[model samples]
Target chain A: MSELAMHEIDRLKENLAERAAAEGLIDVSYRLVDSPVGQLMLAATGRGIVRVAFAAEDFDAVLDSLAEKVGVRVLHRAAPLDAAAMQLDEYFAHARTGFELNLDHRLSSGYRLEVQLALPRIEYGHTASYKAMAAVTGRPAAVRAVGTACATNPLPILVPCHRVLRSDGSLGGYLGGLDAKRALLSLEQDPFGN
Target chain B: MRLHGVKMKTNPPFELVVREHGPAVLRMCTALLRPGPDAQDAWSETFLAALRAYPGLEPGANVQAWLITIARRKAIDSLRARHPVPVDSLPEQAAPIDGFGPDGLFENAGLWDALGTLTELQRKVIGYHYLLGFPYAEIPGFLGGSAASLRRAAADGIKSLRKLLDVSEES
Candidate 1:
């Protein structure tokens, strides 16, 4: 193997990685980010951020889920996630109130979809009871269903599902785990048991 | 590892294919085409095409040989494009491929120079068998030569390259 051949191959890899998305080879692009909560996995489709998984959730398992649900054209590309990472950095630092990134919520659907869609309406730095979220989703009697939705929220913090709490304002179960839920609520200035 | 109702058989991912055989394809491309931008273009095009065609590629196929064959065709296309039949006046001196580019990719300039003089078939035969370490028997499927003939041609190519390069180094 000549040094020239090695150089050529490296250049080809760089070229491919740089241009794969534009070339339409990469369908789902993702990246790993560090946050106060933990390492977060950010994956995006052509439309927007599709999945945001917490560290407690194995990143590989999350990726495999994305592969199974989405297409297998997945790649660890950082270009699409660059703007999202900066926004999330501001978010974890408590400097940014809400994410401005477009999101694709195809990871969940039906009643769960309605609950997830209603979560962001809780507003940054605000907490909502499961009953309140259920009412907002036009399913006032589905408070328990709302809890299940918040519990199973695939996008978690990015979708702001962590803002859901009990009617008494007690910290509720979070899909990312209790500690992560508390950490996110704390990051948003939600005092415990308020 | 699957979704409900729709059963998809996952082929080995293309990334593995690239990591495994990319160097050989690049080297083979450089051997057949001129060792510069043209060869580099050929290499890129080969993989880009392979990536497009990968999903339908038959199961348990020889991936390396498949990639090499694609690179071979790409290199030939690039060579023809670069050496378009002389329109009015024949250009003086063949294309300059004696050394590495702005970056020092070639450790040996004499060998690079020697490679440029070999016929395209000789170059492919030698690149697949000698440079890539593919068995002679495996190469015959991608290339037209029998194992024995490819062995002979590769031997002759190496001998000529050694003689040409050794003489040039002394001068």
Candidate 2:
């Protein structure tokens, strides 16, 4: 074959590879949610919610993290999160109060799990101090530790760490940011208020 | 404030739209700006802006194009803020090519180095069209120019790069 023909063949192969890779990426299910804090992109495996990211966060990181955790290459598609996105839209619209979807909690580890386990118990329109959360976890003096746990909570709003507050009736630090914390608190008080 | 009333109307099923477009937008940003911390920051900001404006997107529109445009604007703003001097200002080092096959087509590190020498706009056009396989029509919308202008920009950029790389290959 002539060099030009060889080049043409090479180009065709490259195009085929690129198409296959793109098709693979498009196979993953995806959705967006109007969370109290901001718009969120959610990705899921066949198991459960694999990744969630704020619009501002590097979404590639979320996908990469999911790929690492699931031990499979995550294809980017919007089908999986369709139900979750609807539920989230309802939650934001004040038509719903809680998310009832199955979650893949494999990413939560150690102290983060302890904090997350304490989150759902934090009733809507209410708050819990870090000390209170620590006390509930049978580590009464580990308020700082509980705060660290909250900071590391991978699922954020889903885990309800925003309900964990400072001991002094002030808002504590949130992994998603203070504005998110405030929005969640405000939404709980009056889901339609924000 | 009633200014909140002006918030864009968000369509239902928000996560799906974001997931589909997120990687493309990230790729665009990475192509436009230097990879690393700054690009990461810009990526996040772009998504935040998208989230805030999600409610306003019309149903069944091209969400990928919309997100890419937002990312492109955010990247430009970041470049302005950081005032990344010039591509030539940095040392002329080549990025190691990964995931290439045995064909040796990508082994030409000098070609990539020459590509790096182009202006930020030129580099972005090349990356999006040649590397990422985005359609030529989409280039104008992302770069905020006419389709003809984008085509010319891409052609000129490629011509300049071939010359630069050819010289380097001879050396």
| Candidate with the greatest DockQ versus the true structure | 1
Give one digit per residue, the lDDT tens place, for model 1 in A15-45: 8756676688766788899988888899998
**Each candidate's TM vs. the true structure?**
0.64, 0.48
lDDT tens readout by residue for model 1, B93-164: 212222322112223445655776877667766655443434666556556658898878876776677577
TM-score of candidate 2 to 2 decimals: 0.48
- The superposed Cα distance between candidate 1 and the true structure at residue A108, in angstroms, equals 2.4
Report the lDDT of model 2 for residue B37.
Answer: 56
C-alpha lDDT of all candidate models, in order: 0.71, 0.61
Total clashing pairs for each candidate:
1, 17
| Candidate 2 CAPRI category | incorrect
lDDT of 2 at B164: 73
Error of 1 at A52 (Å): 1.5
Each model's chain A TM-score: 0.87, 0.78
Off by over 4 Å in 2: A1-36, A192-194, B1-171
Off by over 4 Å in 1: A1-11, A166-172, A190-194, B1-40, B54-72, B75-124, B128-153, B156-171
